[model samples]
Target: MPSESSTLHTPAEARVRPVQQWWALSGRGVAKVFRNGEFVFAFVSPAFLALCFYLPLSALMDVYGVDYAQFLMPIIVLQSVGFAASSAAMRASFDDTEGINTRFRVLPMPLVVPMFARLSTNAVLLVVSLVCAAVACLIIGWRPMGGVVGTIGLFVVALIVGLLLGLLADGIGLMAGSPQATSQALVFPTLILGMASSGFVPVSQFPEWIQPFVRNQPISQFVDVMRAADTGSLTWEILRPTVWWCGGLFIAAVLLLRLGNQKVRA
Candidate 1:
């Protein structure tokens, strides 16, 4: 008979195969989420919210020039990803309450499976929302400065940012007792953070007190970097701020995920 010791491996090896399996599980979960009417509603309803918000900005189109659309396009993508990522937290809290975690733990699975599965699923939803947004932008007369490739790059950036945000949200859901509270607590930050970008209005037009800070922020820099590849030329000046933001978020995400791991699902 094989020794019991032969059956054992380091936690490192035990975790490796499970992580790969977890990613495959995430792919299936995302496909399932797309089919759920309720989840689809959660995914697409925000574009409606945007149309209402865009009404006031319509007249500004004449005053600001069609150029405004170029800037607005990137903002919509960023906001879509940011908002959708928060759903991962809500989903996690709901699943935990439903006792989904217990069943998952009993399976030969990575404990991180459900958490990231929901997150990756929401990230996929954000991609759908972005395509819808691109359509809206074209219908409303928005044009990208860079062109097709540049616009696509902007979408990619939005997805990466959304992925990081979803990871953060998953951690948030784990620590908070209720999804409503966690979701609500996150709303303020989400709204305010996007405002700091160049999408809503030009930074040059912002009040003297607010202009300096928002202009220097990551979202604005990201908008510039992504837009440069399409509308303008790609340069370090445009890419640097986005790079910095992603780097910071990467560290914070790892730390938060680590903290959440202490909760032990069983």
Candidate 2:
């Protein structure tokens, strides 16, 4: 026979539905992001990037007939997305290092509930970062050359890419063992891929030997597709590579997430 006090705490009280657990955890994550000043960085980073690049290189790019600000918008936006994803990684790493995930594993919720919550927090941050990026772009002379449909397509692509990147980063964080290690893991890929891609300059401007690689890389593909979408000239041929790259990223993210789950259980 249980004590009267134990009877007051029923099984229903002890066990929440997965959805409820997920929502509660998500709320906690979202609140933490705001409370910790991550929200301010979401706005500041894009603005800083826009100013740094647009001021120093705009004149040089003009000599080549490039509207540098307009040309730079996609990358700026992508950088903001990247920033959000990196923050997601940091959050996940902190949770892992602090044993929060281990505590969650001992709870009655499903294994995926905490991941879903982190993802939800990432989604919110992604959207905020995108909006901030757009505002930064506008300040630096980027305009929507794409009409309604094309503009919609541009953002849809960005959202998908951001979500996928966030998922991958979350897994990387979980596997990294420490916050500093997770950040170090992300730095090389972000810097190398960002600088090597078509986002910063025209593919034709690169050395002939590197042109093929520059034109075909995933970041380059995404940038070209985004540029085409911006100008209302998007075609299936232009978008095909982006689709494939995104598919590959999705697969990678899934595998990383699975590994992260296993690590938590261990």
Q: For each candidate, what TM-score against the reference? A: 0.82, 0.93
Clashes of each: 4, 0
RMSD per prediction, one decimal? 3.9, 3.0
For candidate 1, write residues 1-266 as lDDT tens digits: 66666567555677697778778878876766666553556536546645755677767865867455555667776666665667677766666666777677778886767666676677767777777767766765667766677667767777778788788777777667678778786787777767766777778888889887788877777676666766658777678778888888888777876776666453
The number of the candidate with the highest lDDT is 2
Q: Which portions of model 1 miss their true places by more than 4 Å?
A: 1-28, 35-39
Native RMSD of candidate 1 (Å): 3.9
In model 1, how large is the Cα lDDT of residue 134? 70
Clashing pairs in 2: none
Tens-place lDDT per residue, model 2, 1-266, is: 99988888776665757778988999999999999998899999999999998999999999999999879988998999999999999999999999999899888778999999999999999999999999999999999999998788888889999999999999999999999999999989998889988898899889999999888988888888889999999999999999999999999999999999999999
lDDT of each: 0.70, 0.93
lDDT of 2 at 153: 85
